[model samples]
Target: MATVWSVTSPHPVHPLAWLAPHAARRRAAGLRRELRPRAADEPLLDLAGNDYLGLATDPRVIDGAVRAARTWGAGATGSRLVTGTTALHAELEAELAAFTGAEAALVFSSGYAANLGVLTALSGPDALIVSDAANHASLVDACRLSRARVVVVPHDDPDAVDAALAARTEARALVVTESVNSVDGGLAPLHALHGVCRGHGTLLVVDEAHGLGVVGPGGRGLLAEAGLAGADDVVATVTLSKALGSQGGAVLAPAAVVAHLVDTARSFIFDTGLAPASAGAALAALRVLGDEPRRPDAVLRAAAALAAAAGVPAPPSAVVAVVLGEPDVAVAAARRCAERGLRVGCFRPPSVPEGTSRLRLTARATLTEADVALVRGVLAEVLTLVAAP
Candidate 1:
């Protein structure tokens, strides 16, 4: 005989009570997160932010934001299909396409939305999506929401992608990958992936979120560096938040693909347009990149210095991950850095895999020699203390 379970409480239980145990479990696992807001002018040396080019505070960028706000108001006011499409948005889209060597471009409110828009709009039930195992969270979520058969191959493995594409029976196929791995700072083999994609007659989607303003010649992007930009079968997505030091995203693809996304992408169709201020700021950032072509080199050099200080391989992009192998250790190390007047990023699962929690240090083009030296000293000291028995 089986015993039947019954609620003994006379009143109804709280609907959110079930979340308490999960929160406790997270605490036990050292994965509970908290928000710590900073002041506008904190004295700490910041190495955790994604402002790769350090243009967020540039006078030109700020002026661009102000100008756009004055002209078009602070908000977009409506979706792109409605009243949200401003002249600034059109100009930004045109410039982005020209800079990245794409036939056209479509701006979104964020990089996440751009990923979601392109993936969901391009693939469907009868289509197959080949994704890299280490793709960003946005790409993973996009794959899940695409309603397509998704096969996640090993990270940076073109042969695995080729095999997956070869084995798929769907009439249409899409291969999505990140040009740079956001967590580990690994570079994808764009040329090889594109070759495999061409062989399979599949569309290649490269997320240049971490690569756009830090990789390629003159910060065009990884796709442009590989000579695949503007290819009819290729598409790229980028965020204005990272190296651009702005706040938006755009999809670079053939004109037809942009048209398709504008029509069919639910994220784009239902979501509000990118803010006018963000569009203006991004446009100004692009111009700054054009004028200051060496900014990307500065970022890479800083990343190399930081990686050497951490005794890790030089990262290909602005992100330098120093793995400490445990969430508590990473968190404690970050806290120690903070105590030492250095602010860095601490990432734990599910941001990274179990046992690979790390300090995610971002390099900025504006980092002075003194700043780098101080960072080196602090990293050496903190990492040494953490390694002590």
Candidate 2:
């Protein structure tokens, strides 16, 4: 049986006509994005993911998730402000706050949402946001959504941030930056930036998405390493997906600030709470890290070994990026590595704000010395092939 009910269209349109030009443009520029499926048991050397501590596949983490699902079901059902807050959420929040040395913490669905929640909730037209030029896309989007005056300072330049903050005398000021940049794997001078923010009486919002679990004591993060953790005017956002090797994000600040976010953060109030399984997994991972303090060191060692072998500097965190000046060359080099059974990340514009292209590699604690040697050999061969004659 066939039944149809249709309404008249206002204008005629070709379904594939609009997409053709965009597709052509992408193809010509070698910017087309495609999805590649990975099988559960597929054999490949993994280096592209953000699993710095390699806890994502840990037996304890998996067991935690399984237990949580069996006990709490899969979904949280509604917004946290409504029916979503669970004991697991409360436990995770408490543990994260203590682990990071924050007075309080609030968990969100993802790090992107946590940034959005904090920026949008705290700043408005009357505020001025001074941001690093190389901030993550989430922070950039947060600034845009805040409806505040945004001043983008030079990347990792404390003087630039100070100047921007000083220029905005009449408005409430906020300094936004990433502790460890995702693209080039550069580390921000957090202590210097904090001093500048302190002098200007501005709130320093540090995004430790890449730094957490790979820096500071027992992977406490950049803020703790800089001696800024739990400061009255300092706030930090971290992703549970990376260091924790689970899921979700959190904003850590003073108790009063967290209270304000609980009442005002749109993302936390409207979005469904994080899944119980992820919360459980994150909790377990955190516990494991706390018990086994050398995991972070292992990851950093692996990254350093790979960087040394490649004749490139190791990143401040777990990321080790090998610079390849041209986009096409970087892409080809990454493809060559992949062909040799090694998986790596190819970062090009607009992912890299500096306009330089590179192959971004992440080092995991689970990566063996043999694995590092294999990756180094593969990357060296690929670069040799891609280098100009």
Which candidate tops TM-score?
1
lDDT of 1 by residue, 1-389 (tens): 88464668786566577899999999888899999999999999999999999999999998999999999999999999998899999999999999889999999999999999999999999999999998899999999999999999999999999999999999999999999899988889999999999999999999999998899998888888889889999999999999889998999999999999999998898989999899999999999998999999999999998898788999989999999999999999999999999999999999898999999999999998899888999999999999998
**Would you estimate the TM-scores of all the predictions?**
0.97, 0.95
Clashes of 2: 0
lDDT of 2 by residue, 115-231 (tens): 999999999999999999999999999999999999998899999988888788556889999998888778889899989998988999999999888898899988988888899
lDDT of 1 at 45: 95
* Per-prediction backbone clash count: 0, 0
Question: Which residue runs of candidate 2 sit more than 4 Å off their true CA positions?
Answer: 1-16
Go through the candidates in order and give the C-alpha RMSD of each one to the true structure. 3.9, 2.4
Cα-lDDT of candidate 2: 0.89
